[model samples]
Target: MTKTRIMIALVVLLAGLKSNGQEALFGGQEIVSPEINKDKSVTFRLLAPAADSVFITGDFLPTTKMKTPMGEMDAPGKKLLSKNGEGLWTYTTEPLASELYNYSFIVDGMTVRDPNNPFVIRDVSSLTNIFIIGGGKADNYKVNDVPHGTVAKRWYDSPGLGMDRRITIYTPPGYEDSKEEYPVLYLLHGAGGDEEAWMDLGRTSQIIDNLIAEGKAQPMIIAMPNGNVTQDAAPGMGSDGFYKPVFMAPKTMDGTYEANFMDIIKFVENNYRVKANKENRAIAGLSMGGFHSFHISRYYPNTFDYVGLFSAAIMPREDATGEVYNNINETLEQQYKNGLELYYIAIGKTDFLYKANQDLKKQLDEIGMPYEYVETDGGHIWRNWRIYLTDFAPKLFK
Candidate 1:
């Protein structure tokens, strides 16, 4: 064979080797390196099969329903580029000031993961790639040698609800060292979750231990309660109707959470060695827990000095009625003037609750209520809530 033919054969062999032994090609798409610039802008490229819409979705960007529409692509400081025949899509985003973000792709209305990024986090059954930027106070939220807190599973009977409920509580590292009374943060679990959700999945104790040891966060007791309100929604609900009736309601407003949640708080304060005053008391939760926080704190403003809602499900003005609305309006007005010390609302950009949170912020803004609104990365996942607690706890009792 001639030299040219030999060279052609060699090139074909190399291509065959790469195709057979190397990369796993899924829909012929591979994510290239994602680069973060000094301006905090992130530029990432993905090689994929030519499709109608190859939109990039992440914690920084809104979740697109159908990939092709790419509605409102002109997000401030965002740019998209695609090659004609190569099927390479590149995206450049504005400087994201968050510490962590999770994202995925929408191809023709179907959500898919980035093949290149190895760091993926699971949200229920779906998975998304995560990217972190601008490391903030949450850098110290790992397990450490500081006086570690202990997580215990405690059971309780709710007479009003006529059910036996279980709860998880975390005692600060030095609870046994001295008889000093500590403030307590009543954390609530979200929909489709149970009492042990915060400790088992959210890692409340570990985060607290690390934060307290580093002195970045205060050492306090955290009580995590089951936020499910349906009588059949305890851990082993056999029927689907008992799963999430609140979410399925006509307006998605939970009317049953207020009474049961208050009972749990009363139980914690009365039984535990917690400070009884509002200044030393707080309430916070995620998703459904967030709904509980907003409802509980607004109803019983004098009972808590700090209120945090992570991706809270704020009830619409039309939905609020009866005692719930009257209490929320009165309490919000009073708290706005008296100052609750801390009123925080945090949600991820890609989360479905982001727009709702923004709407709630707007309402608070209209009322001149003083509260912190944080937009971070990742959807409605425990990872985002864990980070929120880490940042939020230190700001309390200070």
Candidate 2:
């Protein structure tokens, strides 16, 4: 190419890089959205000169009634934002308790995330910005200076489901350096959640790392498998192309998942350096995953020495069928006969599955099945689940 032509092309490229449209899109000065004050109060801001109205919705806010497909129910509350002279909308809240919270902005009636905050999480299909208030229970949810563990996304063959699926595994610190074999904790997620649920939303790695460092919990390996039988992995992560996630998927609560549960256990035991014995193994889940924990623990009697159900769904599905679902009482009897080191059940008083868990306790009482029951405040929510894990993990593999 001629020198003149090359010089002209360079000039044109430089001009395009500094174009007005490009500047408007990426050249603006950055502003902080969520600013945590010394007193723990948070101030949220947004610059929208043309926006007619703005509001902030968050789980930490007060509860309000919202309509859903099922009916009008209590949902997270939103607060209006006031605009300053520079057209910057802002809102400040009273001191918040130490915990992780998710929030979204409603600008001109459209819900959006805080562009300034890079921290976010995806629950099902919805994504929201997240921040942590340190110095209490939330301290465990944050990444501190303690030794961190390794988290890997691995694919394992599931012959029962006729496909290769993904699983999230968390190996404790020093796992790779030491010659020790760790105990395994099979953590399951609820419906609509895939292998990534516990790792992302539950803060499993951070909590466990903090717990182990504090000497509150034993060092162990956590294996999270997708509970949805029809899915190979999280949305857009498997053979099925990119797709939106839903609250519930086909064959979630069915017996098929339980029937093929051994595949995950086998994969973990075969691949990882774990103690492959009942006394060294633990199983726990939340919501529908809790339901699976209940059935799987009983069906595979003498498998797990420690079992936990957090706000578990305990009702028997009449339509579901398989060897796992059959002879529930007989399986429970066998499980009790085999012996359990610790059977833990925790639930919030207002959880939808409270009555079912209570009934389960009653049946266990009839048979004199020993279990540790913890009843806390609130309903079926992540706050309770995180608390449950914090309380439950310290008691395992002891």
Candidate 3:
């Protein structure tokens, strides 16, 4: 080859190598000159792996709803470059929104973490890169000098599950000051969640603090527990055919969890100045927690007066089967007459459990059970759950 030809070939090879190079651990792909256009269009380029398809899944796109037909991430707009032999790929697309969004890349049926972005967030499954399009409400999450609840990490022995577990409890402000008894709310978490799920991911304490300070919610003790009933049911049970942590199932029952939860309640009442009565106690949760709240409050009617279900997994009477059929009616009847004071059920419009929660409302109506049903924006996510707790707390123990 001539000198000019050789120089051109070398430059081309170097560019190819640069594009196909292995990305750093914290940097997966780059969105070259990501910008919001004058036409209200946001555009960016994605550098991906070779021989792979890249789909941009984020909150801005309606096609990204969870568990829907169009939810699967597919290649966006056009392919910027073919996957080189070195396993590198790149693409670009223009989305409609400029707001901050949470997204991920689905490469060959596996969700790969974003390497280019330093901000990482975790759901039940894996961590993904977080991107902010337009600036958001950062002041909302900042911890102010407001009176905050004290979080206690306590350990308890569970005879039901045959294991010792740890739980986190948040004592509301002035819990130690007044000798007067206070009410308690037991907040349960969903599958693949732990005791810290509410405090860490849901930010339940902050929501409660803000609501109570604003006089929108009453000050109450929030007891968050590890809701798993079996050894295999705890968080991090992947690769066991159960991709997500299993919810309440008959096959996984251990008698000790409910008893242990009660023990915690009793302990709180005895150790602290709590009301310690059914009228002052409440139980609520999301997903698996919702199922637990429904089942536990139903079975132990004398324990809790207020019950809230956020994106509950329990189906309606028409769709009930086996164990659900046997207990739902009885549970509804008990909740209607004497067991519960206020039964609250709320689910997001886009949540997968929306239809199920709606069916549950219908079942409650058919059985003459009284309840407050609410549907809101967002899905079965922390944003909704946090808002659920914020809205649900003021109505308790009033």
Candidate 2 lDDT over residue span 1-398, tens digit each: 99999999988876776553223444323566699999999999887788999999998898776664323434678999999887789999999999999999999999998877878999888899999999899999999999999999999999999999999999999999998999999999986788998989999999999999999999999999999988898999988889999888887887888888999999999999999999999999998899899999998998999999998888877657767788888889899999999999999886767888999999999888999999997777788899999999999999
Clashing pairs in 1: none
Off by over 4 Å in 2: 1-29, 65-74
Give each model a TM-score: 0.63, 0.92, 0.68
Task: Output candidate 2 Cα RMSD.
Answer: 3.5
Q: How many residue pairs clash in each candidate?
A: 0, 0, 11
Over 1-398, each residue of candidate 3 has an lDDT whose tens digit, in order, gives 89999999988876765675444432433343244566645454445444356555555555432242212222212123345554545434454543335556566656655555555665555565555443333222335558887888776665545666667788888877776777889999876676767876676776677777778777888888777655432354211334553333332223345445666676567667788888999999987788778777876766888999988867443323334335657766876678567899998887777777888788888988889888887676665676677778889888
RMSD of each: 8.9, 3.5, 8.3
User: What is the TM-score ranking, best to worst?
Assistant: 2, 3, 1
Error of 2 at 329 (Å): 1.6
Give the alpha-carbon lDDT of every model: 0.69, 0.89, 0.65
Of the two candidates 1 and 3, the one with more favorable lDDT, higher being better, is 1
Off by over 4 Å in 3: 1-56, 65-101, 105-119, 129-142, 174-180, 232-260, 316-327
How does residue 23 of candidate 2 score in lDDT? 38
Give the candidate number with the greatest TM-score: 2
